[model samples]
Target: MPAPGSAALGVDEPRSASAIVGATVTGHHLLHIDGYSRTKHKLPTGQFIKSLPFSVGGRSWCISYYPNGLRSEYADFVSVFLHLDKSAGEPVKARTKFCLLDRAGKPVPSNTSTTEPYEYLPGGVGFGIAQFISTAFLEKSEYLLDDCFKITCDIIMSEELRTEDRIAASPFVAVPPSDLNRHLGDLLAAQDGADVTFQVAGETFRAHRFLLAARSPVFKAELWGTMKESAATMVSLRIDDMLPQVFKALLHFIYTDSLPEMEGQEEAVMAQRLLEAAVRYGMPRLKLICEDRLCRHLDVRTAATTLVLAEQHNCHGLKEACIEFLKSPRLLEAVVETDGFEHLTKSFPALVKELMCKLAAH
Candidate 1:
């Protein structure tokens, strides 16, 4: 016989009295299988029932029942365990319950141990009620039918934590950044098979039409739409308003889908032109990046100019930020002297009125 207070589950698992057991029954999940005797009699103790599926915490889970012992040592008894679906992609920290019921729906709580909570990580340990009723003992009992017995499992994960171990992690395969940028950079740098040319301020930059069409809707329209500008080997664009440095920055963005590194003053200087180009090219993300950079550099000297740029580009966020910045009379007095203030006052006279009212109120 097992020694006094010794566990029959072999590992001497943590008992129900441990505080890690279910603190709150968030919800219950149950499973029952029949035909216990005729089918399970021939199976080995270590065998598991067909994986029963359930879900909690918006994650997948599975339950396993070992009708006989999980090992030869425990073959005389039944074992049941709960397994987390590792394919769910993360560990599930949870508390588990296994219950055995008689035909009368009466409880058999004598030894239906509730396992201490554990994180169900991939390739990690599963939790269970190891010391389920003995096979021989239940064979003659009412719960064992002519050939079957039913088992149920209840899982109520912590609303705060999906698993018991907060730090536990499942095996994972790392995903590195794709080589899209590198390949595109190679294509742009080599220009080995350039199919098109862009003429900006009488300077020509060689590029592939397909690459530009892929990155910008404006380019797509010009290259592939009714315009069909790409049908020619070289397309002349009168981008006289764009500086060569700004155009270079724009091309770097198209090829890399990211900004090129620039010093502080250079970055600020490039922002307005980049934002205008982004809007002209129909790239909202690039426009937003430029808007954010511009916003970070706002000062009395730049506020009025940025306000004009935002209004011209329909950048409501930057416009609002500029208006808020000029709430100070000193700031507004300083901004009104800038070159762009004449344009802002003429374009948005109502905004000037609103600012005057705020200054009077202040």
Candidate 2:
């Protein structure tokens, strides 16, 4: 037999799609410093104490905590440094972030410090902030509970830039699709460190503020922007006019970038609600996915409602799909008899007129 996927077999030879991706590996370590008052007096200005070595991105690292600051000029401030503990032949490029934790073990967003990617040479080379926090503020803040506090360091290291071939034919190596979604889904289910809560339709849901802020601008604004919903240590929000299941589905998509499998006629109704939720939350991708589902599930019973939804939400593709489905006179007549038809015609007279014009043109 001829070689598989080869031209000799009267089949076009298979070719691999290749691209150069800048891959990165990330890891974090949290260091708890006990007896902060005792340690603060022991470390003189420009002196420091080191945390136990931790490994991140295959490199050994440690944090140098200077309780009295790194220099006399900054003596009134607490300083922190990230040092490379292991020697390497090539320069390692990495970005670093230091975050101070509250009593709840959540990073205080206002107190977090981040550094740009920097190349570290061999030996014990390090980089960090000299004015991490003011000593007076740390002594008075809630972060200093019983003379103890915690800090977390996150490291993102850049790996070698290389091309990867995604092959359909014979290949020596196989790379599986990313399981980030699975990990994120597990995080949502575990709710181990959820920092925000939502009460929707008498049901409660817990989630992380950072994750929510990262996913949606509306969420980001609500959680951390000028809108500033509330200042409670643990924020609890009451979401009105939304079903619990719809909010749950929206959270699922926010975390996993994919929706849970919904089945049958109820799925279409759920998609419609989810589309509205997506719009409310400023999640365009989710809105688009719901629109696509609505398009596929369009029927005489749902066509009128979906068309009204498409019109209200500015869903061009779904609007076209709805119009196409209503083109048949029998289907249009049946749609007109549906319950939503009255609401559609009354609430959106312009859309009704546009639909009539489209039909007349056709």
lDDT of 1 by residue, 117-151 (tens): 66666534455654577676677555767666666
TM-score of 2: 0.53
Which is the leading candidate under lDDT? Answer: 2
Weakest lDDT window of 10 consecutive positions for candidate 2:
1-10
List model 2 lDDT by residue over 1-362, tens digit each: 00111111011111111122358777778878788887788767867777666666566666778888766766998877776655555456667788888775777654677875655544434667676777887886668988888888877776652224211222232222245888999999999788789999899999988899999988898889422554445788889999898899899999988777665677788889999988898989888878866776888888998898898889998899899988999999999998899999889999999999999899
Query: Which residue pairs clash in candidate 1?
Result: 36-148, 93-162, 93-163, 93-164, 94-163
TM-score of 1: 0.51
How does each model score on TM-score?
Answer: 0.51, 0.53
Total backbone clashes of model 1? 5
Residue 19 Cα positional deviation in candidate 2, in Å, after optimal superposition: 18
